[model samples]
Target: MSATTLLLVTLGLALASFAYGRSRAYSVARLGGGVRSMHSLPSHYGMMVALWCALPALAIIVGWKLFEPSVVSGFLQDYIPQSVYEAGEKSVELYKNDIGNLVDSQAIADIQDPDKKIAAQQLASMRHISSLALFVLALAAAIAGATLALKRIKADTRARHNVEKIVQFFLISCASIAILTTLGIVLSVLFESLRFFQEVSIIEFITGTTWSPQTAIRADQVGSSGSFGAVPLFLGTMLISFIAMVVAVPFGLMSAIYLAEYASRPVRSICKPLLEILAGIPTVVYGFFAALTVAPALRSFGATLGLSVSSESALAAGAVMGIMIIPFVSSLSDDVITAVPQSMRDGSYGLGATKSETIRKVVIPAALPGIVGGVLLAVSRAIGETMIVVMAAGLAANLTANPLEAVTTVTVQIVTLLTGDQEFDSAKTLAAFALGLMLFVVTLCLNVIALHVVRKYREQYE
Candidate 1:
């Protein structure tokens, strides 16, 4: 059977074994007078048996899947011709790839030799046998574990405690997976960024004003000297993100105030969800809207006013992005404002403070931490944004703050640097990693600052 089908069958067997364990436990309890005489519930006994039956067998299957290719290739050496075996690693890799193609009945890259064809068929047969052997071993393990668990089940067995421990172990395993995954990402980025730093000077990358990431593929190539200065990209990113925040924060916060404190229930309910729908729309759609509608409109408007706005300007992209992130700020602020204890507002009223006065002094301060978090989230979103900037603000890494000028961001440059097939060792491709590392650092610093602010304000109330 296919591995998926076999896994399902194994799970089915575990379920069946659980029922059998439950019945056995019930019979044992009846012999003692009733289930009240048992140390654990019948369900706990069944769950314990199910865990024993599934865990070991599933682990074997997972290990086999993970290691199957290397193990299979190690033994397949016997079938490889002596000439193929004498080849270097790259050649051996090609030979194995050819064999794999033939085994899967796919086209070989070149003319297939009869000897190699024979080896491919033989390798396929061995793999089939290996799979069958694994299936038998896994089934035997499950059966053995289930039998041992059943034998342990009695009127006084601590089945619940054992099952709880097993559940706790699984929970810890899941939590470890998340922590390990994050560590893996950080290490991968750090290593690749270090490789980038080797080719490009860190000072030049950080302080240099130009950011043309071209690398010389040939000695005589034009415009390929490649400047790695990140200042222009950073300026463009800040310009766009600042414009977005300027457009988003005040409007979003004011809307939150209206919805939380002033609006009727029906109006609040209707507007809150409608406002949040902006966050649900795909960013690519916003990109198109910015490119096709907002950019053109802004250009035309600027022209009528005798201002020379670029066709693809940062203003168009930033304004559209602000509209997109409004829901993020508004929804978060509304929730936090509402979360301020109603008693605080009542006390303000008792002090002869108006609703507006109370909101400014008490409600806003109480929700400042959450509001700061939301704004920071929106800033991160703005910085990481790509498609909208690409579509609306053309990818010119110009070092200017004018919103009417075309500009690009670190993310856009990273995408540009790593878009096609590139040698990882080349400074051009490695630059992408450097940019990513820089962005991560920038966001991390922002997070640290936000935390400091939140803690400072938090203690004021406490």
Candidate 2:
């Protein structure tokens, strides 16, 4: 049977087991004192039985799926010609791939080679036998588990405790999967970055000024030696992010304060949703707006002021990015500010303080930690943005702080470096991993700072 079919069958059995277990629990309870003498509720007994029926069957299905391919491949070895094996491991792997492809494409009847034809037929039969065996075994296991659980459903059984333990184990397994996935990503990047540093010095990559990453494949090719300095990328990223924050913080914070503390109910209901619509818009749409509308407007404005502004400049992208992130700051800050206790504001009023004084002294201080968290989230969003930068801020890695000049960011460069069919052993390709490692470190530092700030204010307020 297919895995999905088997799963449906298992679930059907579990449902049946649940109904039977609940009926049995009621009977056992009636024999005592109408569920008062039972150790656990009827629902708990039902849940325990359903879990017993499902868990063992699901485990067998999962284990079968995981190792089925290797087992089948091992069986295919007997049908292969000895000469194919004598060729080498690569040839053997190629032979296996061809067999797998033929099987998957259902072209077994069209097989021209005599040996391959026999092998394909045998492979099909083996898979069918394996699947039939799995179906039978899963059902048997489910039946056995349900029977054992039903027998144990006495008045003294602790069904609730057993169910809770099963749920706890499942939750722990999920958390472990997430942690291991993150660890794997970090270790993979770190290893590749170490390879890159071997080819290009870490000192030169970090400290040098110019930023060109085109390395020629051949010795006779031009620019065989590439420059890997990341200073320009870092400066461009910081300049754009700084501009974005400058535009976002004051506006977002003010809007939040007004909506939370001053605006009437009707106005707040209408304006808050309208403002948050900016966040719902796709980033590509924002990029298009930045490139077509914002960048051109900035250039025209700068021209009127007798200033030279590139068609694609940092200011345009940053401004648009800031506009895009406004909802993040506004919505979060408004929630935190609105959550402040009413009695504290009343106390300020009792002390003859004005509305502004109460907000500045009592409300803002109490909500400072949450406000910092919101701003930190906005900062991270600005730093990680790629579409706006790529569209409005042209990919020229010039190391300048001027907002009117064209520049690129680390993410854009990472995308550029890994864009085409390039050899992974080259410095040009591996530089992406090095850039990723640096970006990770920078984000980590930001998180640490945010944590410290949150802890400080939380202690003072709470």
Candidate 3:
């Protein structure tokens, strides 16, 4: 049967099950015959039965569809003539493709040989028959399950509780899917990095001070000894993030204080969202502003100060990133500070403390934990950020403390490593994964520490 036919049949079954469940729920409700007589509403019970009937059967059908082709193809490999199978891997692949085409079309012209043609036809027939029987059986089982559930529905049945439990299970399953997806990505990166490690030793990749990934393709080729020192890239990331935090944290916190504590309602309403407008601006736009505007200005300013400054300096990129994080810090700090009870501030004021003293000594300390949490979150953002650094920060990896010098970041290295036509097993490609793993670990640790600090400090206020 066609895919469309299968879909239509499944949809029709689901709709019928829904109708049956709804009718059964209504009958039970009628028997109960009073408000507050059931654990939950009748509709929830009906939805529960419909979900049970449809979800399990659908999962089976989907699983079969995904695996059947692979299983059948593996079985068919043994039936092919030994000569054809032994020709070469490529030839065998072509033969499989031809057979699959013939089966799908239900025509034998591609097989050419009479024996292979006959076998292909027979295989196709068997596949079609099996698919039909399985689909029918699945549909029958779904219908029977729905019927049984409807029959079991009665006034005393805990159908509502069952439905709620199913919903909770579904939510948990969705959360698990997200977690599994992350684990899958991490594993895939790790496996590829392992393949690269086979080609280049861990010592050479990690400790080497130079990073020129263009390796020679041939045995006699020149410039084959490409260095892969990760230290410079890591330093560059740290420098940029540190600079950004310096710019963003103080400015953002001060702004938050003014908005949360001191501003009139009109000024607060206008200024709060207007400041957030900065957050809405695209990162690419910020990238260009960093490259075209900020970089040149910094270079010119450094020239006047008699300092040797590169056109694309870490200072420019770091400064721009700082601007990007300002809103994140400010908005979070604002909310946390505003959430502190007015009674605390009033008590401080009654003790004859000035406005600034109350704010600094009382309010800020109360909100410090949450502010630290915001800073940690911003640090993660700075570390993971890509575009601004890619545009404004120079690509050359330099182990330098001078902000005026051009430097590469870890994220930039990862971008270059994975860009262009890449061999998956090459050290260059695998370096991206190693960088990613390191980045993940750093961010995770920061988050845990931030949460702990926030919790402890919050308890003090409580």
Query: Which model, 2 or 3, shows the larger TM-score?
Result: 2
**How well is each residue in 1-462 modelled by candidate 3, as lDDT tens digits?**
765676677777777777777776776677778525655566766776687677766776788788877877777776677788679888877877777778878677656788678668767866887688768867876777777777766766777788778889989999999999999987887777677677777787667677777776455767565676777887899999999999999999999999999999999999999999889999999999999999999888888999877888899999999999999999999999998999999999999999999999999999999999999999998998889998998798988878888888888888888888866655667778877777877888999988998988898885
| Model 2 misplacement above 4 A | 82-88, 218-222
lDDT of 1 at 230: 94
Which candidate number has the best TM-score?
A: 2
The segments of candidate 1 whose C-alpha lies over 4 angstroms from its true place after superposition are: 83-87, 106-113, 218-223, 459-462
Candidate 3 differs from the real structure by a C-alpha RMSD in angstroms, to one decimal, of: 4.0
Cα RMSD of predicted structure 1 = 2.6
Superposition TM-score, candidate 1 onto the true structure: 0.92
Stronger candidate by TM-score (1 vs 3)? 1
Per-residue alpha-carbon lDDT of candidate 2 for residues 277-341, written as tens digits (9 for 90 to 100): 99999999999999999999999999999999999999999999999989998998999899888
Assess candidate 2 and give its TM-score to the true structure. 0.95
Cα lDDT, all candidates: 0.89, 0.93, 0.83
